[model samples]
Target: MMEEKMEDRNKIKTELIVVIVEKDMSGEVIDAAKQGGADGATVMYGRGSGIHENARFFGITIEPEKEIVLILVDAAIRNAVLCSIQKKIEIDRPGMGIAFVLDVAKVIGSPHLNLMSDITD
Candidate 1:
């Protein structure tokens, strides 16, 4: 008979950076992520509807085109990547856009994730 043991997956932590910015500046955003040590990024188009305020003309709606960037990076370089993006995009300024990081408990499909974890560890 063979015995099997389960691994503790919680020990591995990853960061998912969600960045929303001007559609035309998505290339810059991805560049920032790469400069910050991110291996890859995914970008998508979207529209903004934040609580800040909205302008209207003739009782019509106006929405700004946005690019949503998704970057999954190793926990070790998460902060550095975010800072790099901030410096290049001036994320601190109003109307620039919003960015946030989420805790990724698990990831799949990316074979290099293990290599990343090992290097960071």
Candidate 2:
């Protein structure tokens, strides 16, 4: 019974979508993702050292500031969310940004997810 319950709980697979964009773009990205079916996102500030990201100032190189947006959503909507983000930001263009998806093995401490599972069960 426990095994079956676990399987049922795990039926809704999760995916993590990570978007790295120029500074101050996280809000736009988050809005796009939400429009694409994502619930929410987490944003963090970072710096990039890519060749195109470095700017020379007074003979010194300054790494471009970046914003990392992390969105976790059900696997079923990953593609739609990615497409929405691409449409909004043109992430494919040079220096625009980059986005990737990763399979999430496990997730915890998410009240909404827990509530969803309870409602489904």
Candidate 3:
């Protein structure tokens, strides 16, 4: 039936994983994701605020720096990638940054995939 085919196709859809972590941990986080199942990741600088702010030892104020990593992966590997990052970064603790998965409606510009049209004239 048409519905059955649609459901099967959806199984291979892609998703986006967003990880915000301490600036220095971004590299390790991405590496763990790649080892788990993700093909690649894009990281960028960012800043965030939460209940637990950094404490200053002296007169200077220290705002923690953060890095955001975006990873687009096949839905099949979403869970594995998330777990790998969490295990590597020890995200279970309170102050560590957060990570979430979003259902990606579409993806583009990834050079990692090679497709075959398979059309004969």
Candidate 4:
């Protein structure tokens, strides 16, 4: 049936939202993402363990603070969401943060329905 085919198509395409923000800017980044049409997001705090020698300060340890924000959106609005967060959070600045997107194969839950409804319109 057409409905089954449409559902199968929807199941194949997904938006992956990845945001790496300074620990202090996580809240602002998440708020910007929400304003940009993200239905929900997950935030995790972590310390940067980059192997770059320059990543450290004057012989003392310089641990870069980090927060990772993950939001799974419908494919259509992924770019807009990324741009909105970038604009509001100034992610392009040095040591500020970074955000990227990926393709998702499938997802499970009622939340996907809500996201699909919101993004389709």
Off by over 4 Å in 2: 1-5, 115-121
Q: Candidate 4, residues 17-85: lDDT per residue as tens digits?
A: 888877778788778878888777888988876564126467777787789999888777777888889
Q: After superposing candidate 1, which stretches have Cα over 4 Å from the reference? A: 1-10, 51-53, 57-59, 115-121
Model 2 score (lDDT) = 0.88
Give all candidate RMSDs, comma-separated: 5.5, 4.0, 5.9, 5.5
What lDDT does candidate 1 reach at residue 93? 95
TM-score result, candidate 3? 0.77
What is the lDDT for 80 in model 2? 96
Sorted on TM-score, highest at the top, how do the candidates line up? Answer: 2, 1, 3, 4
lDDT for each residue of candidate 3 in 1-121, tens digit (9 for 90 to 100):
8556545544557788999998798899889999889988999997766668765778776777899999888878899999998899888788888999898654444556321122231
What's the TM-score of each model vs. the native? 0.79, 0.88, 0.77, 0.75
How well does model 1 score by local distance difference test? 0.80
The sequence of per-residue lDDT tens digits that candidate 1 reaches over residues 1-121 is: 1111113333557789999997698899999989999987999998888866466889997777889999998788999999999999998899898899998866656655552222223
Task: Give the higher-TM-score candidate: 1 or 2.
Answer: 2
Q: Best candidate, lDDT-wise? A: 2
lDDT against the true structure, per candidate, is 0.80, 0.88, 0.78, 0.74
Cα lDDT of candidate 4 equals 0.74
For model 4, what is the error of residue 25's alpha carbon versus the real structure, in angstroms, after optimal superposition?
A: 1.4
